[model samples]
Target chain A: MTDIRADIHAQTGASEPGFGDYVTLLKPRVMSLVVFTALVGLLVAPVALHPIEALAAVIFIALGAGASGALNMWWDADIDQVMRRTARRPIPAGKVEPGEALGLGLALSGIAVIMLGLATNLLAAGLLAFTIFFYAVIYSMWLKRATPQNIVIGGAAGAFPPMIGWAAVTGSVGIEAWLMFALIFMWTPPHFWALALFMKEDYSNARVPMLTVTHGRRSTRRHILAYTVLLVPVALAAGFTSIGGPVYLAAALVMNALFLHGAWAIWRRDEARAEADGYRTEKQVFRLSLYYLFVHFSALLVEAALRGTGAYALVGIAG
Target chain B: MSTRTTPLRPTHELHKRRFSRNLGVGLTLVAFIALVFGLTIAKVQGGGTLQAYDHTFRPALLPQDD
Candidate 1:
């Protein structure tokens, strides 16, 4: 730990972070996903919101996601420096100080929660607060290092966006909201496990108990296949909900077929074969997983748009 | 006898630029907070009249009343 601190000090001696570095600290990619899912939740809700209120709700939810990202980076600075993929992140790369990251995160968290409550409702704001705390304190600080089930339970933090968005509009959670949450929650393990398979050494070096590090690659592969199988039902079931439509069902069928095929391909590959191919199948599955979630949500958005235009009325499935 | 030369100091212009940047950031944050507060108040008091502020900042897609 001392060596890590010394390494950080050496790298950051006189470095001055640019505005972009501060933005990087917020994990913009993760924030984008959060914002998109939350927006879908808000738009798909049965209730109506004024344009300004919807916009404000999305913005505050985004800020809360950013705050969680910053706090995660701050808490995981040590392991971050060890991981090859994360070594160049703001704090680890010495672009931003840990203290600055913490302060920014705390400030953003407070602002997002307060403003969300004012803009939407107390339920949404409260959920946003819990999401931040769960990600930062529970997942990042505790679960991440403690168990192989880290991503399993920690996935809840990422799963809350749509629920919060639903709450923003309806001031309560519903089955559809939980279904959206469930889709992401189920997707996280296989998605992360694929990355972990390829980046085994990083988790090993960081001593983080990612399933890959603890249970070995063979078990991780089985887990990936299992979770992907489990995820299919959730993903398919969502397409039958009020938010679901022909577009969503079509997309779900095609995407789930490809997703399952990819998972099965990984499940069949031995460690030696994976190593021989540089974990290509695992990496492909991981990439597909990203599109899988995005397309699912996008299909929901399309369903909502179709309903907006009375197109679903033709099919008589307009709820 | 000390023989090491001291490093050149940053120029006054650099200091001024830094100060100005800091001031800009500070002001931006303050303005943003004020905007959020003002909008929240207007939202609570005005009910569904968010369209009134549309001229100031219009959303790309407006929600329609059914």
Candidate 2:
């Protein structure tokens, strides 16, 4: 069966976009975060999964996350065009048609959810569906333009992967799963707020009503400090869970202390001082926040590994 | 008889992109098929054995008198 569209464009060549543009619409960086967190969730669960099943579960989870990203790109194409950071996206940059993105997003969403249900369990599949809906419809369509607390609420969509991953293994959610969810949920405001501080002009220009846009930068700074202060307890409390051990406690303590210091520094600064330094402190906090979550999750992974080998038992912290 | 010429000229850039797109879709489909096949095999073997309506005289699994 020949493609009539391709045949029509054959001779003169309409410069049809290549497949990589489709991949770009998936937002690979954000997909990496979803993959990592979900992988950690699956690996650290109490029950051991066959390696092949685990890999398949993670792949479907990632595809589900990517589908959500594509849907987000489809829905937010207008604002994506307006913002400098997202101006070159496939739809906005004219590489791919908006309808193409919407079709692909929808198709992939169905495929990922169905495949995940087949590969794992219905609960994980259902959660992926909800995550997709939350990001595409709830967050992108409604909350983003509706209010300043957008990311605070939208962060739940991102936070669901670990819970889904945990469910994939155990067939149900648990306290530890919620703890992981809380880690990302509490960390999101402080993390994105730092980026909003540095990228303040971008949000306001797009009229997305980021905390910095609706609330003043002073208030945004205060919110960042407040969230950071609140995030510390959640981050540290994971250390006492089944996933945590001495390694996690140590990492959480040091990282949370630095995080608090960074937040406090941002809180103390005035607009002129921040502008003079090119928002260096804000940028540093943002960078540290990236490492903060990765380090915490990695520490949890390490504790899980040590526990598996009875290393924690020697130190009297074993299950 | 009109000669059957290829619709897409080799020299055209769109032809190249079209080729790339087709190849990408082909590879992705193949990978998906492979993954599904592998998953089926893995699930059947490692996902626990399927208990049919009746196996080869499994007296232990048969319903007992009350």
Q: What are the RMSD figures for all models against the true structure?
A: 7.3, 3.9
DockQ of every candidate structure: 0.10, 0.42
Write down the RMSD of candidate 2 (Cα, Å): 3.9
The best candidate in terms of TM-score: 2
Q: lDDT per residue, candidate 1, A1-319, as tens digits?
A: 1444345446555456656677888899999999999999999998778777888899899999999999999999999999999999999998789999999999999999998998889999999999999999999999999999999999999999999999999999989999999999999999999999998799999999989889888999999999999999999998888888789999999999999999999999999999899989999999999999999999999989899878768778755
TM-score of chain A of each: 0.94, 0.95
Best by DockQ: 2
lDDT score of residue A96 within candidate 2: 88
iRMS, model 2 (angstroms): 6.7
Q: Lowest summed-lDDT stretch of 10 residues in model 1 chain A?
A: A1-10
Q: Which ten residues in a row have the lowest lDDT in candidate 2 chain A?
A: A6-15
Which sections of candidate 1 miss by over 4 Å? A1-13, B1-66
True contacts kept of each: 0.03, 0.59
Which parts of model 2 are misplaced by more than 4 Å? A1-15, B1-8, B47-66
Summarize candidate 2's per-residue lDDT along A204-243 as a digit string, tens digits.
8999999998889999999999999999989988888888
lDDT of 2 by residue, B5-62 (tens): 4454576677678788899999999999989988877776653334443323455655
